[model samples]
Target: MSRLLLSTLVVVVVIVVVVVVVVVVVGVVGVGVVVVVKVVAAAVVEENDYVWKNGNHAEKTYLFLVTNTLT
Candidate 1:
């Protein structure tokens, strides 16, 4: 009876460890995706002087502008 209890405890401990590892991996992946989306969004906002394309295959328009600021 003592040996059986020991075996059960070992199995439970291993299962718990595996679950923790999986949770950590999933969390890391989620954070990485969010970071990538944020970077793309920021780039689009910064380069607003460039033309925006709705389709991947072709360019639709051109933008030209001039600005000077010294501070």
Candidate 2:
């Protein structure tokens, strides 16, 4: 009976550890994705400034509105 109890306890502990590790890994990955997205968006905006400036007034206004909403 004691051996059975020990094995059950070990299993529970192992499951808990695995869950915690997975949560931590997912959290790190989520942050990394956000950082990468922000970096890519910034790069695109920098490279497209002239394109935006050359667009019509209505297009420029819509672009600014979208960019403002995002930030």
Candidate 3:
């Protein structure tokens, strides 16, 4: 009876250890994903701002060309 109790205790301890390890690993991976997503979103916003600025420059150039041609 003592041997059976010891084996059960060991099994419970191992299960608890495995569960803790899995939770820690998943939490770390989730944090990494969130960081990567934030970086990518910032990069996208910067690219969009650059494109918008270039578009305005092009519009000004087009207007200049049209006014010069008319003159």
Candidate 4:
């Protein structure tokens, strides 16, 4: 009976660990997707390619410039 209980506990622990790992991986992947989408959308909307300073003006640029400048 003790052995059976131990085995059940172990199984439960393994299942919990697996679930936590999966959740973390999914969260990380979701964040990555959001960042990529934001970047791509910014690039498409800005119409001024990121890192291109040619013929640049202050106000016409997108919000990326402010963050880029700070970085």
- Give the Cα-based TM-score of candidate 2 against the true structure: 0.65
Question: Candidate 2: deviation at residue 68, Å?
Answer: 16
- Score residue 18 of candidate 3 by CA lDDT: 100
TM-score of 1: 0.65
In terms of lDDT, model 4 sits at 0.78
The lDDT per prediction is 0.69, 0.90, 0.83, 0.78
Q: Which 10 consecutive residues of model 4 have the lowest summed lDDT?
A: 47-56
Candidate numbers, best lDDT first, in rank order: 2, 3, 4, 1
> Which is better, 3 or 4, measured by lDDT?
3
Query: Compared with the true structure, what per-residue lDDT tens digits does model 2 show for residues 1-71?
Result: 99999999999999999999999999999999999999998997875696597878887888789879988
Give model 3's clash tally: 0
TM-score for each predicted model, relative to the true structure: 0.65, 0.65, 0.72, 0.65
Give me the overall lDDT of model 1.
0.69
Q: What is candidate 4's CA lDDT for residue 8?
A: 100
What does candidate 3's lDDT look like per residue over 1-71, in tens digits?
99999999999999999999999999999999999999997996676566656758776576557657976
Worst 10 residues of 2 by lDDT: 44-53
RMSD of each: 9.3, 3.5, 10.9, 5.6
How far residue 54's Cα lies from its native spot in candidate 3, in Å, is 2.7
Summing lDDT over every window of 10 consecutive residues in candidate 3, give the lowest-scoring window: 59-68
- Model 1 bad stretches (over 4 Å): 49-71
